[model samples]
Target: MTTHYLTKLLRYRAWADQLTYGAVAALPEGAAEATRATIFGNMLGTLSHTYVVDDIFQAHLQGRSHGYTSRKMPEPLALNELWLRQQAMNDWYLAYAQALSPAQAAEEVSFQFIGGGDGRMSREEMILHVVNHATYHRGFVAEMFYQVPAKPPATDLPVFLRDVSQP
Candidate 1:
């Protein structure tokens, strides 16, 4: 990946992560249970799905089988702990991505997906998928927050551009 593209993606990921973490922290203890029923089955579900998928891909990158049969949803009692775990994993991914060379990014990585034997993708493609996947789910979570009085944080690409364009 070009340095410019990587930088833009990194910034977008950071912003999206911040918004997701903020929304998760703002929920009341009981709200976690109501989350799924209200606003598209709860931000927690979306966040959990995001984390699980990322873990799957990360393990693939590291040449390990992703043992998960299904995406795990965060328990209401352990939502905070799950959020913190996801944050740490995301931080690790960002650091790994930033350190990758352009040549490394273009190189193909081989791995297996559930129900499949082997698969391959360029490192650049994997990084793009991770960012795109997170953005897609983050939008879902953001919509869940729409009915609440507090304005949802902007997760739009143009909004990200505007922030980056600022001096």
Candidate 2:
């Protein structure tokens, strides 16, 4: 994939994340923390899982240990705290993507999976995974929004492309 396309994807990811977090934060007290059928327990848990994965990938990109034994974070952060951390992570990704050269993006990185196994992917592939993974979990968060009888923000890539794309 071209760096231009990847950078746009990263920007779209950040935009979607902001909208998702905003919708969750606006929910009534206990709404975000409500028990759900999702694997991560609740909305916060689901989002936290995405954050942990992002952290893990960030370390992998840097060729260092991520210190995460599992994708699940034992203690989920409060909505505000999670948003803050996610924003920082999002910014890091944007900067990283912006700085990535064509060769760097194509270079394969090998790392140990948190679930125990060898894994490898190109740097661009890793970035794509991070963005795609978060998008997948945000669907879970959107599902939880209905439990609150609330409408989640439109976070589809098309929406981002149409409404937020920059020149």
Candidate 3:
């Protein structure tokens, strides 16, 4: 069951990343810099925050402390660079997960949080948390795209499954 869930989550993450990159690519050159939000301050900032959080969680899964200090807004990379990096990270995660056994998934792992405290969780739980975290942020990005003239790609899990099923 855990492996099945992991497979679905991996697929969802890949689909979501592709959708995000597509939306980001369609934006005007300076659109990410211009769009402001109450919490994230801007689209670029929000996306950077999402990336930073993912990095932090990835480090945690590796039993290391998070290195990022602030959610520094990444300079707009070329669409290819952005998409390639996202795809690489997602592929790495899927590979890591596929290598795990049920016993490994149930094992407790420890790592330090960004601020100061040590944290521990089962590998399975951590993987699920990472998926949930990405989903939440992707939803935010999807909302940001809704305000723009060009429609973002459909990010819903069912939509992703349906599209993948067709071909």
Top lDDT model: 2
**What TM-score does each of the candidates earn?**
0.81, 0.98, 0.84
lDDT of 2 by residue, 25-52 (tens): 8899898889998899899999999999
lDDT: worst 10-residue window of model 3: 70-79
After best superposition, candidate 1 residue 25: deviation in angstroms? 1.9
lDDT of each: 0.72, 0.92, 0.72
Which digits, one per residue and each the tens of the lDDT, describe model 1 over residues 126-165? Answer: 8788889889888777666664534567778888788753
Clashing pairs in 3: none
Go through the candidates in order and give the C-alpha RMSD of each one to the true structure: 3.0, 0.8, 2.6
Say which candidate scores most in TM-score. 2
In angstroms, the error of model 3 at 161 is: 2.1
Task: Give the TM-score (vs. native) of candidate 1.
Answer: 0.81
Superposed model 2: Cα runs more than 4 Å off = none
Total residue pair clashes for candidate 1? 3
What does the lDDT read for residue 53 in candidate 1? 78
Error of 3 at 123 (Å): 1.2
